[model samples]
Target: MFCPKCGATIPDSDNKEKSGSKVVKNILLVLLILVLMAVSGLGTAAYMMFHNKSSGATYEGKGYNTPEEAAKAYAEAFANKDINEMLSCCAIESYVDNLDYEAQIERYGAYMPTIFGGPIMTGDDEATRQINIEERKGQLTNFIIRAYLRVSQPIDSPIFSGLALQVGDGKEYDADEVVDMLKGASDIDSIKVGDVEDCYYFLQASSNDNSDKIHKTLKKVYGGKIEWLGVELEIDGEDYVMFVDAIQYDEKWYILAPHGTGASIAGLDVYSGGICELALLD
Candidate 1:
């Protein structure tokens, strides 16, 4: 008999059992391939989803077309105590990209021998060293970001109220309370965007030598793709300005962290401080 699907002649009754087994094997093989393809598709989709989320491409507040818009959104998020929104407006991926473990090691390698009495060893081999560096970088980034978020809240909101942060003066205060005091005594009156050009110039002029080097490095790396904007928050009639470093990635703007105080906390060598005072208003 002829097989209808393949138009091939089927084995006769003499070989019927063998022919049946062959057909079953083929069917099983096709099913296995289908299953593998489905799994691969799902895996690819999942990876893409994760990448988009991490890169802020899928973030709701990531669609800001300009630096001013992003800064305004961040200020509004801060006022509303919206953590997710505030994070969305940040250029987290940019900060991550700028973290160069290899460069850091190279720059600090000379000092390591003096401190350790020998060459500081990261791992047994090159591959292992790379893996170890990446792991450390991830840990450092997480620590800095978490610390920043912990303090980046309204002082009166009760969020992170239990966490005590010591300011430049060596006085310990509740994270929330410190932020509230910095924001001012009353509710938010208005959020204003300062001139981008003027903000950039001010940042460059006011930055210390190390900070100036970082700014220049970032400018050299990003060229015309990055911007500096000042976000002025008028609370209780007092105008407090926060300078933000906005980076353009995939045609979207995101606020770069470790700009003011964040950078100081993370160490200026690890992350570059922007041209703003205290990195952020808070």
Candidate 2:
């Protein structure tokens, strides 16, 4: 039976054979459509994932030819004052010894304003060590006297040799000064020039700026927590360890010179933190 106007389900009037085949075909078609939809969706998802990874700038800017190449490149970037390029190369975390991001960034940024242009130039051919410290000159707008950083210790100590190294265009000390300074340290404090003939000495510091005033500056190198950090430097093409002593100069402690290598001083950066120099690695 069928309803008038509104067609309703009724007993099949046509052949059962035809109805059964049509029903199976329709169901199969629906299943095939579902399968195709699933495959299509999966394919689309995979393609999108790959595309996203490929497109991201962070992923697109790949890195160094090699670790050494990367380091040299970064150094060049730094030397050239290419801030963004250097930062791009700099690791998010360099090492356990490395300063945190804000501190390091601020430190590096400070160099940008002046260093890229040149070290201050002066006609005075004479140099302290190798640094022809052309006075801050016209660059420094605030001529107001900066608080002198010099501080002192209660005890007077014998000062020995000194070695100063100025890397880059600001090359400060010469090989001669460095050699003499190292040799002199032996006579300071102990007055015991060791048996080892022709001993070498190197530039010593915890960090870049805070040299010369080890006792005061050492505290800072350790972030005021530990006592000291050491630097490794090449001297006369030979390398040696150093223990520093500072003297008050102009209300600041200058490296009156260092008190030679202590009796049992370890090599540079052996314990203190830094990107250990090649000498240290060797």
Candidate 3:
């Protein structure tokens, strides 16, 4: 063979070397294209999976366009005692998603009664049905909070009562009686409570004269176990610290033992405890 550009005679050995080099270069190019295609395919698959998992706030479902809408639909379903519809509005937490639907509801029953008024039961189907009925009432109460939210109502609004219940073991008080108990308590200037869904309560309290008075009052209400109600607000020129209380209770707000007042309720794990978020009404 001869070089076309230079018109120089070329050896067979040189021609063979050049041919071999071209073949190797072609092979390498093909391999690179294949690798790139594979990578692209994997990336596309991952993106599609993520997109499908997160259907966004606009998921296609009846009466649910956003999280708030889903919440309302779920609450309404609970009120109507439609378990299937309530479950439809809910996307299980990933950790608990592996559990079957009935199991999920049963697990939810631990804290379900707090927001959906009913007795917590285990095993028996009859007990489960009765609990479901009670939960409907609990769900209805929480829905009132949602109704307040849709109109931009503040947490301090009397339309929703303030959070002031002792979660001790006892017969539950009616809502009116609970409010009376809170109002009757001493050492607080003003208190306002509201519910954020069926999850938790928002509480705001102003100290009467100074922090000392409020602190003493809390000590009285809670019998010296009042470490959490330490919320304080300054009106004229006093400094106050606020406390967030999370307590568990019955259908009527009877006090549960105040141990696990953590962020259980808002996180939908209220079977452990309920929480009170205290802040200045300003």
Candidate 4:
């Protein structure tokens, strides 16, 4: 050993060169790790950006697989004959109409064959590649859907147009049609229940036939509570608020709401009668 106390080149057998080399390798490894961390962060950001762009939408209530999923859920409710289940899937505004879910269950129970067996999907405008189901759901709650999809086009609720067209089509109008329509229009407990003012002039083309009969039918159902409000439908065993979307023409009035629902009626043609299903609150 030469000059052991001085800083000088050591013998080849010493570990100094290897120690320096190891420190260099550690520095390189640290730098490599930092680079990898940066790359990982960038990749995460890119994934989030793409995912948000492709599959994200802001929703206030209820988790959903898609808008289509909600639509299908509504259909499933009907298919299972669980009226409350179907209503539970609906947006708040519909229930807010004062026709609470319980009323819907009682009034619509007799018509399960029509509601559940009905199609949840259909083509519009000759298969124009439209988002019709979403548009329909955006238009009406399943409780108010009707086969008179044609009538549902011009008017807001299929219940009204469904009945009008049914009567106009001469589908053997009976007491049930009148009862169903009147029931759908019955949620007057709250002011906004009947929204015909929000939708206008489509039924001007309806036959206006049996307007008096329609009015009387309403009175029969509500037990004439309107007094000056013309005919009414009886709540009878129902626990629902009632209101009407009435139209005056040829000196007669028509009722739509608690009396009208997506519930279907027999002996009616929904199309060509210028009626529509109730509007949906998506």
TM-score of each: 0.42, 0.19, 0.21, 0.20
TM-score of 2: 0.19
Tens digit of per-residue lDDT, candidate 1, span 259-279: 543234323222122222233
In the order shown, the candidates' Cα RMSDs to the true structure are: 12.4, 23.2, 20.8, 20.6
Question: What would you estimate as the lDDT of candidate 4?
Answer: 0.34
lDDT for 224 (candidate 3)? 28
Candidate 2 residue lDDT tens string, 132-211? 21122211111111100000110111111123365345576556654453342232221111111111232332233433
Q: How well is each residue in 84-146 modelled by candidate 3, as lDDT tens digits?
A: 564444322111212133443443454443433233454435345334434443443344334
Candidate 1 Cα misplacement greater than 4 A, ranges: 1-63, 94-99, 104-197, 200-216, 219-224, 261-282
Residue lDDT tens for model 4, 1-282: 455789686566457789889999999999999999999999987755432423332111242343334434433443343444544444322212222223333444653434321222333341221233233233334334431222213334444453454553556666575555444223222111121221112222222445445445543433221111111111222211111133221222212221222211212233322122322111
lDDT, candidate 3, equals 0.35
> Model 2, 116: alpha-carbon shift in Å?
27
Supply candidate 2's per-residue lDDT for 31. Answer: 100
